[model samples]
Target chain A: MNDASSQDPEQQSMPPLGADHPSVARILRRWRQLSGGRHTRDPDRKTLVACSGGADSVALAIALAQIPSSCVLAHIQHDMRTPEQAEHDRAYVEALAKRLGVDCAFGIAAVSEEPGNLEANAREARYQELARIADEHACPYIATGHHADDQLETLLMHLMRGSGTRGMSGMRPATPLGNKTLLRPLLEIPRNEIETMLRELDIAWCHDQTNDDPAYVRNRIRQDLLPLLRRLDPEIARHASQWSQDLVAMQEVMDERVEATLMEPCTITDSQWRWPRELLQAHPDIMLGYLPGLYCLRVLDNEGADRITRRAIDSWIRSVKSDSNNPTEHRIGPIVAHIRAHEVRFTPAESSELST
Target chain B: MNDASSQDPEQQSMPPLGADHPSVARILRRWRQLSGGRHTRDPDRKTLVACSGGADSVALAIALAQIPSSCVLAHIQHDMRTPEQAEHDRAYVEALAKRLGVDCAFGIAAVSEEPGNLEANAREARYQELARIADEHACPYIATGHHADDQLETLLMHLMRGSGTRGMSGMRPATPLGNKTLLRPLLEIPRNEIETMLRELDIAWCHDQTNDDPAYVRNRIRQDLLPLLRRLDPEIARHASQWSQDLVAMQEVMDERVEATLMEPCTITDSQWRWPRELLQAHPDIMLGYLPGLYCLRVLDNEGADRITRRAIDSWIRSVKSDSNNPTEHRIGPIVAHIRAHEVRFTPAESSELST
Candidate 1:
């Protein structure tokens, strides 16, 4: 018997439903269900797999092929690397796609010589190409094999860069990509799992030499920093992924609060926009969050809304309490909060307004 | 020439005020003026310094002593390391308080044996002791020397531990400690400044050996991690402190939304409660934050609303959307948001209602 049938039927089949190997397939099935079932017109949906032919994406393509789904591979020639190596990578991805009985599409884009916008421009160009392919082929989704490890790396990058909650939340699995959905089914799978799957499938994938170069901050993190973190905790990637999920949930709540605060109706008078002081006082915690914008209004004497400091908010609170008998106005960031006629008023300064 | 004369004349001479130390004296004078120059007999006004005889707290105590107000010092002996060292610390604080002509008090507490609760326990014990001292002296406020560095440390700890916005907010300058207010006047000052002040004042301080010990996670962070971070960016601590202040402001806004979400009236029917599906969907993010407690409500059938999980919340959202037409009551977490005839209704599960 061949290797596929040599093992016990139970072992050779799909393994147990929730087994490690089954997890990838399970996730793919879930993605399909969530996306309202698999596409039928294409039979084997000509998915333009954004494969640099790395272990993660190559493993993804191999596993996907086993699931009786058709896929088409797409490789972007980001001419950032040596011309010889870039061509080699493109050839590898195209050859792999052909071996898997799928058509291949390739695109080349000259990276900008400009310093700051290089990374952003390359990403935009690649995505723009992928979106075009999906539109032309009438494909429902474009799959990218971003694993749990990649998600963790993204999260750590955001944290290191001092990003807000939204940034720290990391990537979503099936966000809208132009007219099509960008499905990242491999996101729940760990990096090691992909490597193991690649080995099991007897697939060879190319590694990008640039990943080892520490000149780029992201490469430094992925190569040096993440290894150190893994040493500290072998499950660091999983933990980071879980943390991102939790933050994503928490961020939703924060976003809602921000919306509610913005949507709350207030009468903008000639002097100030009057809001209930009692209501504000009852939610001191909320006031702390709003203080940054409030500070800009008062300190700059510009009625434009901007971020304020906690100290400014505290000072404003004190002012409101101390000057109860008099009309007291305190600026926090670009917003002003004043007490007049027994009511508190909040307004954005003109200079630091949201428009500016 | 005397040490006082050797110093800059501006630094040596008090501001046009009777208080000591030009800058601190100026602040006090301004505070007094702000208070309408009415000095109330605040016999209960006492400052409890969490002194390890460190430069930071020493400077804080010295500054507080120079104020035209009386204060009592309270020290906590956290017997985590050598008991003898803790005793030495207590003695140093006692002697310093005596030299400054202020009342001194101390409390001894065994460190927590549990791994996870070590820091939490020490903090709880310290505050509990402070409260006891305040009650004994009838003091309405307790002061600690939590400088900017400490705030940064706190923010980093919370961030590393995957805490939400509130956890990342660090310590508040003035928060209620039992019946009394816990104040940190040194929060705005940098650690180096406090050290300089101590040197200038010729005040001797003891350094805690445990601060450098790596057995504790925070100590490891302070000794090894923070230095690396500072090397990467010298202003890391300042930036982190600023970030914490911003988060505090944001948290205030979130607290208000949470309250508003809770206050939205809902009817309870039997074992379940319903809220308007539309309303919940309108503020999905807020609902996500409130999901952990809701999940606990469903699983335990007892709703002592505490923590919620993202998965549990997503599941609830999906179910709500799926069963929108039926309008049947379903348990989410500790609280249930169900669709009703006129509006959405929410109530704690019968079992877990007591916790709320």
Candidate 2:
């Protein structure tokens, strides 16, 4: 028996399926594609199914049961509800894993509920614990159950909030987390299909009534907006998902071009950087295109962009492109921009004696 | 009399405002801004107000009446309706122009409508006729009455059809039409506002019954989807319009970068072109980024992209970026592509022995 993926003699010896359920077979096929054909071939590479006894994750766990892979169960209680409810979820997940003859890992937490970030904080904590447990079990993969409908809602949320292409791009099917990789094999599958499979298999999963409460904007989007949009066009969800994929692909290409442009024209360093005077003078628009990325790379990563305004970038870009020699200064996220005749430069807050 | 503006005594000397209607006065302010501060300043430059006797355009004509500019009425009848209805539209527009004390120009078209494209054909004919009229009058600007609500619908239409950021960017507040500029001053104003202003001024404009007949898809969208969206989020129209504006700004910045990058690493000619092997080898994503643009510039300009499938592009892009040296051929529009190791080249259909 391998340490990472002990071939459980009891589980493997258990009776094989008389016939493959279409849904289970489909999920197994999808997992094969998502895991890059690793799970079944290399039993040494252990798999962790991240389930919270929710319908989607539970259905995912049941589907994975059809496959012969070394797997472990991981669950986390957000502790947002009563302790009784939390224990129910924990016991439910454990019981489900026991029925499948798999080892179960529990991460019960009394996470602090912040005023405006309850959902996000809980999600982050769960992911952190999932990663820790996966590492403990030497599992290289953690599969979640985010599907196409979730993809659609995500796009609408991003659009309504005036997010650029980056935010509009939906989550990747696979994302690397430290040494482990997290995968969602059901992004192309509809939520109804997941529910249908559970019923067909006579499986039961926890249903949290609070998620459907219209207090959350995403709930309204899911309950009302998506349905209304579907009535408008039956393929709305598919179209929205396709659009997300488009943006994701577009961002990849744009990222590459912008990165190359940055490397060619700018002097990048840990503390500060400057763009070529001629690049700014002749092709100012390209430099303008790189401003958001510049903020990400030089000022700070990711969150630095939210601190800058499109209007400021537009103005600076306009002045650079046009016949304007007027000097301008704009303070953006602890950095003061100095725009002059030839080149635009930046000074860090500490060296420039900027107030905190 | 200036050559550009022979102020007809009969029209100019007709009357002074008893008390300028607030609506008319408001439009005069907008015209000043849209015409680049030249409409009121140079009566000599002249302005053509494209009125269809619809409520929105009639309001526009009424507004233009308050300004000191040489304005003329430009009306087009698609002849899709009964002859009587067309004649009524013409006569009604002429009467409105007379009341506003401006010369009227008619572009009565019995345009041959193609099957499945009645609306588009009519529109194309109308624009061509409007361009001719503007050129004949030496009018530098052609003002229309596309309001914010119209912008919202355009975006929704684009979204339903899976449009890129360019299509989602909505209509420009101002676009150049041949020798003249086309301006839509009310894009920031709602359609109901236009109707309200007309009612306040006690002005009556012809309401084409056909427009309300939900037979048209746009009418259904306006009548159904928009109302539903507004119920879901009261600011749907405003948000959609803002999204369009954001995309417009994004395109402006991206256009410059893509153009510069295209110039480098690609050898172009009238008939065929090939990318720099090393550039494609090292930064294959850059080539993928340029694929759409290459189809545009090397094939049929911007609209050429509509003929290509995103999935096909994604597949080719994946194969190109990944560690696969698969030889592939995909015929896109009038070009046949040969994508192989180290290079991707485009050859014209005509010279490539491709049959019609």
Candidate 3:
């Protein structure tokens, strides 16, 4: 590890370690830090990396290739862009992975087949395809190319939506996806640094033309908000990620309190999700905290998180958090709330399932 | 008061009550909501309001005047700007306060005599002067002109500096200031609306040149950062303030945990602050929570909050939170620690204070 304390005796905080160091060195340092002090990925364990043939991912792929760990590159052609561009990206990823002696997994996403927002569809399909690829390759950790710039944009996007602590916590460096662990090695690294690293290595990368669209809020934040923030504070991007990181730590501690006090003793049965009536009515604030978890468990079909508004949550809370503890029926989307004597139950909207 | 449910039956949340209503109505609704169902401030009790000749505070003054409450206007001429301009502002405030039948307490700030950063000095002096005026007028609540835009700017400023949850929580709607309560009736309102309110009323307000100078970090944020954020999300200003409000709630809960678990049983006697060594060592995370409370109680000179940096807090935590329970001493700014036996002791930097 780079001892910034030793380098600058006055500087106490982390001081964005390896920020001033070389591009490859910075990535190596950051990757090691992400590995929970393991220093490097074990040679025996093969890792799957999601590469989009864009500068950030391509840069990450290049860095990982230089290391000793075995790697598998997964690329999904969303086909949202032109066919020629998609094919070009696929060919590029294949060639790059092959050159680095890494196994490559390529998939075509049914972007048009998917419903809702194009970005959401592309993102969900990409993640699903990556998970499948990781499973096939027996890779536990699937690293991505989400860098500091992306982190800033994500945090800002959450702020614009008026999201709570969880949303403002931005994306985690590591998270479980189905049975596999998804990782972001370049998360600590800035976008320009990744570009610099690839430039220094004399490697070219493909650009996604769709990213330029102002229709996407994330794109607008990246292309606009970040620059203005930077003008006010030169290191705004770094701080944006850092602030979220601090909030993430704070959230973990607070989440424990919520779990211990508010959301405790709630059980998930195969047919119905249940919470005690007393617990449901006691703390109304925790209802907000518990909404996302319950929604994911209840809602199906697609990513309906955005669709599941606060109204639905409040409506649920009001239904259960009532004076009379009698069995009652309430319907919302594809879920049915069966409020009973001791507990509140949530089942499928279809009454036939309840009958079964 | 506007009951949003009555106005919009389908709306889940309050949906910004009187948002589309007249400017005065929106401000009045927000003020009433701030009162937390008290309806309005008691006419019997006087409330001191800190007003600059600026539009936001001027509009707040105008709105407050319309309501049935005793208001005392408090204005501070920093003397940092031109004498002519300062005199002009004082005259303007006096006339406005008189026109509204509100008692005015205008004061000149000793900003030049104070220490530290110009902005900090000016702010501290202004607040101190307001508190004094509030005390003189026998007022319990001192209202400030910190609107939603200012709150957003404050939050963004803290984030850029990598401040933790305490800093990110932004400002309080009400806080205990000695025997009085510091209030922000206009906190929920936006700056643009405040301007619109004044403009619609055909009331002219003084513009402070200091606010336009790019030398101040805040000015840059207002002129540059806010516009860019607005472009991405039109309601960014409102959301920023709303996000902070949610964080404040979360912080309150977490603070209870900190008080119950960590800061509980710690004692302060004479000039010495004591905490059990085991308790201090066991919870390093809670140290961040406990720092502000301890610092405020310990530090004597003015607010001194901005002076109490994270480095100083961490240093104090580290000095006391060590393995050996030996008689050792460490100093941080004006505070000194003497670690011995089962308890960590904190005293003034100089031993002369103990002798005195």
Candidate 4:
């Protein structure tokens, strides 16, 4: 542990340890900002850092340890890698944690194959394992090493899937992981900086051998699409990362507008919801564009809201605008929109009779 | 050329000429919707179809001819192509126009190579020629053959450049092309459907030889990135196109909010603009996220507002929050943000002292 603050008064004139590495300082500052300027030595500020023994996570751990808060290194051994490689990863993470003078927790990921979604399943399993580790360690936050490049890759993947603004908004800096707050303090930092910082500190990290497998779509995007995009625009990653931040900001506004204009004015329950058609007509910009998908997510709690199509929303809007006195039903995920002359009502498909 | 509506009453009892191919009718209906249901035979509704002798443009011409309104096929002979190829394109467009019983217009595009931006320069030159031809032909609208695939391509291009929602919104269905309205009636239609309609109608179109040239970034993206994305998700094009539409809708909402909240309350002039600090603090979601770029556009009329960066905006916001009574200035595009105690002022850099 490079404890720069504990230097002797005899060496007070000298620059602090790690002063030459500005990236470490940036990481520390960013983490503090993300945590809302909490006291550095706050007893409640325990974070379990998820480390794959990669340069990104190792650098994160190094910077995070400098904070006076309690820090723990966590590793999830997944089934995708061979036993030898997995052991090597765990060993490297253990040694790195020991060097940082932090306790380490190791867990095996029960990654089960789900037809064509093996990669997604593995990620879910890994996160679940991380949550369990955080629980055992009594940490309120679990931090990851996702950086700007990963943010770009995640955004492209969402774009490829035709996800609208919500998906393109990319990962939030801090979001919920089970009951714990998942913190990604280095999201705005680039991958090169993480690797460069590690090299400067003479810290060795193990490479995750499974990352090159083309079986995962993310690898293909990273290997093929990213390089091609970089060639087209060298600042693409920086631009995209910034765009992601902007989208997040924009999404925050949209969510607030939707909540105030649509959700608040509506009568909502677990199985049924109703909104005034007059309000819908008054704010077509919000009603026709953002309300449908958001209503599904916030009101109905539909997890597959992404599957809602633009055509479906258009059709629903048409129904909402129709002057017919009779009721018309339109499907939107698990719920159905029953539009009448003065109001638009939504009911779960199983409770269609309730609308009648 | 396929005059389905001119059938005799006896033949009208049967199916129409294009009844089997529903796509042509879809195109015509879409055109009428795009034009706000103007009288079909209105002489003022003349449109200059920017035909490149490609399948998409040819299909558009075929559909537009079905409308009773006047139509003229326009072609631009660009320097990027050989004279022989340019002549071939012009000849094909002329023959098609003649076959459709409409007039044709031709113009030469003096496309100058701008260092490494030959492709962009050629496109701009082509559009300028199109606008000129539209003006010469007394056409109020200039229609293009940009379909959903092109929209997806555009969104990806903007994404690579790290453009926010405004860029990712892709091409508008109708926007100002010089003095004329540029209409993309086939924007929602897919490229495959356009080609299929052309093949079904037995219409011949010349392949765009320059399209496959790898020197152009668009060509590389079309060939490499699009195909890779399609493999990941077969409906990626449709999804991105829909996302673009959603983004356009979201942007409309954002624009309206910014106008009503920020622009409406501001004291703006050609060289100076001031916004209340209290209003800004009240709506950080709108003020912090959208006001910077949009203010550059709406207030300063700065065409390069896209160059207004997130960092610049963040810095400006920080200054706006500063408690200092002394004025501080920050550069944003061609204008400078001056932060004062009660308000934030913007002035052209040449006129900075006015902000004091």
Best-fitting candidate, scored by DockQ: 4
lDDT tens per residue, model 3, B176-283: 777777778777677877787776667788995536533477777877788877777778778887788767877776677677766667686776667887776776
Taking the tens digit of each residue's C-alpha lDDT, what string does model 4 give over B1-356?
23434522333344433445678778777776666564554356678888889988888888776543467888877777778998898889999977765678888777555565676677788788888888888988888998988898898788766665577679998888768888898998888888999888888899965454435667778887788777777777777777777677777777777888888888977657788877776776435557667667666676667568756777787767666678778887666887777888777666675435
- lDDT by residue (tens digit), candidate 3, A1-356: 23333433444343432234367566655655565546444553456888888998877676655442356788887766788988888899999987665678987677776667777777788889988888898877788888887898888888888775678889998787888777787776667777876776678888855355334788777677777777777777677776767677667767677667655676866756677777767764633445445545545543444455545655667766667766777655466667787787766666535485
A14 in model 2: Cα distance from truth in Å? 6.5
For model 3, the local distance difference test gives 0.69
- In model 4, the clashing pairs are none
* Poorest lDDT segment (10 consecutive residues) of candidate 3 chain B: B12-21
Ranking by TM-score: 4, 3, 2, 1
TM-score of chain B of 2: 0.83
RMSD to the native, candidate 1? Answer: 8.9
Ranking by DockQ: 4, 3, 2, 1
Candidate 1 local lDDT, B1-356, one digit each (tens) = 12222322432444212134553543333223322245643233445556768777777676655532346677777767777887788889999877665678887656667565666667677788778877887667777777777886776566456554445568876677667777777765667767766666666788954344344657756765666555544555555655555456655655556556743443345644455666555564544355445334444554454344444556656755553566545555455555554455555556445644
Task: Give all candidates' CA lDDT scores.
Answer: 0.60, 0.67, 0.69, 0.75
> TM-score (chain A) of candidate 3?
0.75
Most TM-score-accurate candidate? 4
Full-model lDDT, candidate 1: 0.60
- Number of the candidate with higher TM-score, 1 or 4: 4
Candidate 1 per-residue lDDT over residues A1-356, each given as its tens digit: 12112322433545322224564566556446535565543343446677888887776665444433345677877767888888888889888876654567777666657465677767778789888877766666788888788887786566566554345578877678777788887776678887876676566789854244333667766766566555545665665665555556555666555445532644555535555655555454443344344334334453444255446666777655454667776766666666764667666555325443
The residue-by-residue lDDT of candidate 2 on B49-134, one tens digit each, is 88888898888887765442467789887767778887888899999877766778988655554565666766778788888888
Q: Docking category for candidate 2?
A: acceptable
Best by lDDT: 4
